[model samples]
Target: MLKNVSNQQIINVFKFLEAAWSTTQIRSISYEEKQKKQRTHAQKMIDMFDLPTKKKKFETRKPFDYSGDFGELEPLKDDETMFVYRGLEDKFKEFPQNYSKVTSLEYADGQEKMAHRIWTMQEKFLNICKYGERSEMIIAQKTIQIRNLKEHCQKNKKDTLARVILLEQIQGRKKELKKLRKRDYKRFIWLLKELDLLYRPHPLYVDLNTRRARMRQYLREETCRIIREKINAVYTRLDSEKENFYTEKEKVLSEIRKDLSDHNISAYDVLQNVRKLRQERVVERQNKAPPTPNTYRWIQSDKDRKKAERRERDLHRNALVKKGMQKLAQSEEAS
Candidate 1:
């Protein structure tokens, strides 16, 4: 039963037991001895709790001596300097917590402000020492980074980020291809063939070559055509309705113009008269129109009538089939 129990559950049980034991009185022991036993028990509980250990502090390395051996190496060119600085910025952006450690580093320049920047450059150089140039690990790391960047670009709809990611992916694929070519030419050729076939049909079309597949494809095309035709028909109907509405509106406007013209009124007076007449006609129509019913009783009744008709048709068909079977049986018996 304990095997299935979690460490936390066990710890909790132990805590409850400790609490229960503390509440009980022990008359035989002195106060000091009882206190010492309690302290020992607490220490044991602490050990059993399995609390997190403190992390080891990062040790600062001694500053490099530029005077004796190298006498200060040549300063980086503008482009190189910018590249280095950019790389440092990227590293800090990736791991902001590491920035504090870099700032704490002792430097002779009295510019504690620049220590983080210097630390970034030093860390990059150290990484190069630990992991040689063009290491497989570095390539794998870059591939992972590019993949993440691609996902980020896709989510955020960043065109520039997408382009950069695409470029990186292409370059990474080229490197992999180059390596494959050097290691195994056959595999390299196979990969090239695979890439070529990415958008094109496979050489062996076993599944798609069948008559059924052809028929299915034809059916799919026919279905799409039918749907397109239906959509076009609907659009045509809508267009005709719109044209009819416009024509009717034009006719009404013409009648209004003729009516106004008969009065020999000014254009402004005619417009005002048209508006009044239109409003009066609208009010008259509203008054003449029947009031809407509270419920859709007519629609419900129509549906019930259709259902009854369908049921009658089914009953008639079933009766005719049964009569025909009985007649066939009688003919068989007479024969």
Candidate 2:
């Protein structure tokens, strides 16, 4: 039954059991550590007499069933082969046993007692073997499927290693995308907006036309929104702490006042200064030499202007002809 089970499966089982046992022990130790106080006499005595502590005798090593030099065997392609071999070698090196010796007993009905004991021993051994075989069968089946999958991946254009690397990268990107979407989405949008504005003429450098005025309005709204958010965060932090609430509020107000003063503006008269700044920027822009004209653009503008003049002349000529025709008809009717 054990022949069907791969070395890797056995090693994996042992490793899992070891890890789980270690974790249990760690949790138990942590709980005890949190107590801080010393253990009671009864608890200490119980720990001393625990089955794990009492069982100390090393088990005898079993001889390997196969009698071949492992070194002579070809190296396995799978990365887990060496790990499995080491794990199995370590496990078989020393096995613990609970009892050192077995006790014999005598009975009045000797033949019947001996027969019953033999039957019971055979039954126990069979049952143990049956369970072991069942476990081995399950592990062997799983190992076969895993080997098939590995073989399939190896045969395909995209091997397991490449697939694993790709999957890892995709997972990492997904996490980054999730963070961007959740926390930095607004900032990301704002950055895109700024990039778009970079390609266009700046409102301060251009005449305050309808479009420039609208852009300036948008910028002002964004600035106000940022300031309001900052003020709200400060308020929230202050509100959370009950001590010196009034004092904190006053300090926040003083900071705001100082910021406004630095900008040469007052809180109540902010709009006036903002408008003045806009006018000053527009004047500065107007004072600068105009941009050099593009030759092609200038030619296109001249053509458009001539077309408009021609259309106006045609309309005027048509109106004069209509008036002359109307006056002739009235003169004919009067004659």
Best by TM-score: 1
Alpha-carbon local distance difference test for all models: 0.58, 0.51
78-192, model 2: which lDDT tens digit per residue?
2221221333544543544211111112212333333333344344445544544332233222222333333344467557574465445334433443444456566434532
After superposing candidate 1 on the true structure, give the runs of residues whose Cα lies further than 4 Å from its correct spot.
1-217, 233-248, 260-335
Model 1 clashing-pair count: 0
Q: What's the TM-score of every candidate structure?
A: 0.20, 0.15
RMSD of each: 35.4, 38.0
On residues 1-335, what C-alpha lDDT tens digit does candidate 1 reach at each position?
A: 77899999999999999998988857587899999999887667546653333547998753221101112212323222232244465456566754534433332232332333344444554564444433333333343344444445556764775666657664665566567567767754654453231112225645656545655666678789999999999999999899889999999989878876898766797679899999999999988969777698988999999999999999999999999999999999999
Pairs that clash in candidate 2: none
Q: Tell me the lDDT of candidate 1.
A: 0.58
User: How does candidate 2 score on lDDT?
Assistant: 0.51
Candidate 2 has a TM-score of 0.15
Model number with the top lDDT: 1
